[model samples]
Target: MKKFIGISILALLVGFFSANAQDTAKNVTTKVKESAVKVGDKTAELASKGKNAITDKVYKDKEGPNGETIYIDKHSKYYWIDKKGHKVPISKNKLISKQ
Candidate 1:
């Protein structure tokens, strides 16, 4: 009886780990395609790891108040990302023109 119960638990754990294996293999491109939002002439995906925002696009020349180059997500939301990849909110004075 103990042998049977031990095998059942092991099988259950194996099944659970197998199922989760697929989830952990999710790639960046897959995530981008999942969250792709179109904005004007550009498209951006809001990929985040915790509080950190991820961007597939190269950092542009647009500068914010603190002189950090700005980034625009697919939602057209502008932010200044920091060294730690945290999306820092910009001030209203740094509002980006839609034009």
Candidate 2:
């Protein structure tokens, strides 16, 4: 009778530990999924902002000092224009207006 009782107790302990491990694994999976969703949302927001920025920077080129032409984008960083209308990088401080 004593041996039977000991075996039953051991079986119960094993079942309890197995159930607890399963619950822990499920919790970990849920957390990982939540984190993935948040990261995806942030990426989408950044992409939307980038698209809007490009659309807002489209502008016409005009002549500047010493025959060097400047292409001005009211919403963008400073860019210079070549004879072929290609844009060249300029200093941000010179291009951007101080608020």
Candidate 3:
């Protein structure tokens, strides 16, 4: 009976420890994913800025529908860079002139 009690206690402790370890691992994974997303966003923003500066014209006195900076591509197409670094095309009439 004593040996059985000891084994039961050991099993409970092991189960608790394994559950705690899984929680810690999940937390770590979540944090790592968050960090990766942040890094990717920053990298995309920098790349967009660099590409725009080199390959497009920045409309210093204008903005987009969401108040984003405006860029005119080689084809005279107006656009704005979104958070994911994609160009959101806009009409020239929709541009907001900055004061």
Candidate 4:
């Protein structure tokens, strides 16, 4: 009877450890996926900025909100690059003139 009890206890401990390890592995996988998404977004933003710098015309005396540099694309649409490197459209009335 004592031997049987010892074997049951050992089986329970093994099962508990295996369950704990699975949870830890799932948490690690979630963290890695989040990190990969952030890196991809940053890379896309950099590529957008590089393309705009090469293809758009810059406005030397005009500024955008928060002092962002203005640009005119091939379509003659005025815009400014935001912190995330997205082009934010602006009207002539909203432009800040520099002295």
Q: Rate the local accuracy (lDDT) of all candidates.
A: 0.57, 0.60, 0.91, 0.85
Tens-digit per-residue lDDT, 9-97, candidate 4: 99999999999999999999999998887887787778777788789988888888678788889999999866566789999788998
Give TM per candidate. Answer: 0.32, 0.55, 0.89, 0.70
lDDT of model 1 at position 43:
24
Please identify model 3 stretches exceeding 4 Å from their true place: none
lDDT computed for candidate 2: 0.60
The top-ranked prediction according to TM-score is 3
RMSD of each: 12.6, 12.2, 1.3, 3.0
Kindly indicate the candidate among 1 and 3 with the higher TM-score.
Answer: 3
lDDT of 3 by residue, 5-82 (tens): 999999999999999999999999999999999899988988997899789999999988778999999899999888
Error of 2 at 3 (Å): 1.6
lDDT of 2 at 78: 53
Local lDDT at 96 for model 3: 89
Report lDDT (Cα) of residue 96, candidate 1: 41
Residue 10 displacement (Å), model 1: 59
15-36 per-residue lDDT for model 1 (tens digits) = 9998788776667557766555
Best by lDDT: 3
Q: Which ten residues in a row have the lowest lDDT in candidate 2?
A: 58-67
Give the clashing pairs for model 3: none
- Relative to the true structure, candidate 4 reaches a TM of 0.70
